[model samples]
Target: MISGPASVRERRLWMRTIAIVNQKGGCGKTTTAINLSAFLASETRRVLLIDMDPQGHATLGLLRDPSQLEKTVYEVLTHEQGVTALAEIIVRVRENLDLAPADVLLSALPEKLRETPGKENKLSEVLEEIRKDYDYVIVDCPPSVGLLTFNALKACTEAIIPVEPSFFSLQGIARQMETLDLLATTAGHNIKARALITLYTGRSDFAKAVAEEIRKHLGDRSFNTVIRFSLKLPEAVGHGLPIAEFSPRSSGCADYRALAREVLADEPPKFAPSRVEEDPEEAIAPAPAAALEQAESPLEPRMQVSPPIPVIGEGLFTVETPRAREEANSLPPAAVLEQAESFLESRMPAAPPMPINGEGLFTSEAPGAREETIPPALAAVFEQAESPLERRIQASPPMPVNGGVRFTIEAPGARSVQLAADFNDWVADEMQSRDGIWTKVVPLPPGRYHYRYVVDGGWQTDPLNVHLEPTPWGGYNSVFVLEGNNGNKVH
Candidate 1:
């Protein structure tokens, strides 16, 4: 069950703003925003949820009455109304919870925003006014890549994207990254990195597969706590309550709370504001913060708007941004291409051609240098195992084994799967599979035993865990892990 909030005023001291943004609809962007805000509120962290979407799903979910507001975030953005103090419009939900409701007004704000100067940074400016008032300001962005999304990107320091595990989800990340890059260059003033993975189904194989794909791409960016699918998630939202409050006992609530802790525990995001001084470069010559400025030269009588500036410090400095691949000083395309011929030759892979004259012997100084670096490959052979399979292939208790502990396999499909460990010396293999699951009840005492599972005379890794290693064919293999090794305390 969710813990009751302590107090609102006691929590605003640790305010941290976050924006939940994803252009892909049904990816649970609003759901994450609503639930995460709710979870934060439950922790007594003063949360101000901004429903920036015109659809107002977050508004309707949190509000008893949607049309009651006279002024919304929409009005604050456009309508010549400066949003100086945003806390005044906060709709109090629970003790620590407040919301900035949105509806039809936000839909009209976009059109009006298009006509204004410095249009992209309107929301960022407005939120800056209210940033220090609350512990967290979670903005719910619309389900599209438009001006509204851009504004949301500009307003927040970090972003959480909810991506459903499906075919389209991976491709959508590219567009999202491009949009984030656009904002970083233009609208994003103090914005940091933006990333999140959501709508995960831990029970389904497809979900796990997709999650693995996402984790590989995101690498360190992906959160460790994964949210499993549950029926209770929608019910909480339908009741106009946070998932933690409405379905406190549900798995969905637990997942969200875990996600909250992960989010809160993460390092705060930060982006460079007009290129600050990095370490090594600073030692040679400190770079100046050249805001877009141009100076006229008195030497030219028929001078145009501004004198021509060099690439670095000069009259009208056209700051040449470097490509992602280039780490050197900024240069034009011609310079990159001119050096590309040599670079391309170095990077290109060489392949042997078929011999026509049968005299194509290419000799090397040492044949030892050309030897393959990869280890021997091992293939996992599946033998009908349990749903949650446990194949203890080895157990090494160099000392005496008590033999009371019983391992379990939850495979519903297989009627038989045997678990053998080296502790028994493969003679008295204690654990055997039953009811599509394998269980070995034994007294595993103070030693390490390497174990694997034999299912229907075939070998396979455990479903619940994974072991990462290089394969024999210059690739990698995923392995499952079990704890309690090398005199470690047993769970």
Candidate 2:
């Protein structure tokens, strides 16, 4: 809809360009790109999936016959004689989702563009024309690194490297990361690269161990959503449909949806009113000098900016120490409230030496003989007492009521929390939050269960329940046993 270069530049600011790249084959790179785009589009976002891979797996996965296509991304990128618009090759795959299909002919791109001066920037330049048209542009790179992959890296602002739970996959990731770092240093492009664990089978000890190692090393850099191995996934692709359409109830569909939500969560907020007057062209430019300076090293997370304030209220009062403020800002609302209560308790005397009036008010005795009563509303605010929810969570482990187990965790500051357990095939179930406590009541018969909590995209064992079992990977999982109708904490 945006016409001319200026309007395109303005629209590009809101668009998220992501390239799915992995030098290793059979790592679910194409599958991730296709399904992720489909799920994103299902969420009411306009998505354009560009098949940069010459093999055309993404195109075939969407049921688009590349052989019949007169125009593809290859044609648009080559532009042998005259310029070919990317929109001309795009075909609608689903509602709100479009595809620019590719075929084996694209494999010749490197040899053709080798003589071109700005060949690496071809995809980047071509994408500019339709930058304003879609909310997301997902590029499916070839399995091997070449000019095509370089073009993808050059164009995208974010990259996802899908690493399956295999020894070979693990070895390849280090090389893949090195390539990304090389590009960042040489090209000076700021691309936020993240590792996605795919084709994971939790039942296999080897798979679990590999996954744990990836998480341990990557930490927050790796996605918390793991794509569990599913037979329905390959079957759906064979049927020329995404897992969501082919088997909506399948684990494959659920995992991809979770991945899409994780990606959407990281979307940057829109520019403030004050930044409206800034030049649009400059917004799409490479990282500024300030951003570069913030990065301690190229391997570290780039473009380091102060984390956004938590949704909870601002600090209780002006913080005197930078370290204290930083620690407070990182804490969830529940922790912050506890800290405030402790601060209040430390400042107040153990006994006020005041008398309770007939109206249940605290009356202070003074030399002037004037009765000063504490207001009920004001007094309630200053009360250093735990809420009923907090007390219940602290007093008991998951309680079984009405043939269901109620799991609870105190994390008031977390924007979202999910419970994943072996009983549910490790699929994360959203938990409801009240005050600073999160609870999920699941109906279960007598059985043993292993579970973990995912808070704000970080996975961890339940802190409340000390009884934990060591996992295959050097981590722990909380254990709970339901005997008859009553729940028992596993020792």
TM-score of each: 0.51, 0.54
Tell me the tens digit of each residue's lDDT in model 1 across 1-491: 12333244545445566778777665667778888888766654668898888877788788767766777877667644555456656788887678888875677776776678988778767776765578788889887888888778777778787776655677777677777887777643545444555544333345446666877778666565454444346545656777766645444555576677666555233211122112231111111212101112111122121111122232322233332223323545434332322121111111111110111111111222222111011000111122101232222211122355545545557645766555656442435644444566666554434444556665443332112233354323222222233222111
* RMSD (Å) of each candidate, 1 decimal: 25.0, 19.0
Model 1: ten consecutive residues of lowest lDDT: 373-382
Give candidate 1's TM-score.
0.51
Instruction: Assess each prediction's global lDDT (C-alpha) against the native.
Output: 0.52, 0.66
Best candidate (score: lDDT): 2
Which residue pairs of candidate 2 clash?
Answer: 333-413
Q: After superposition, how far is residue 355 of candidate 1 from its true place, in Å?
A: 54
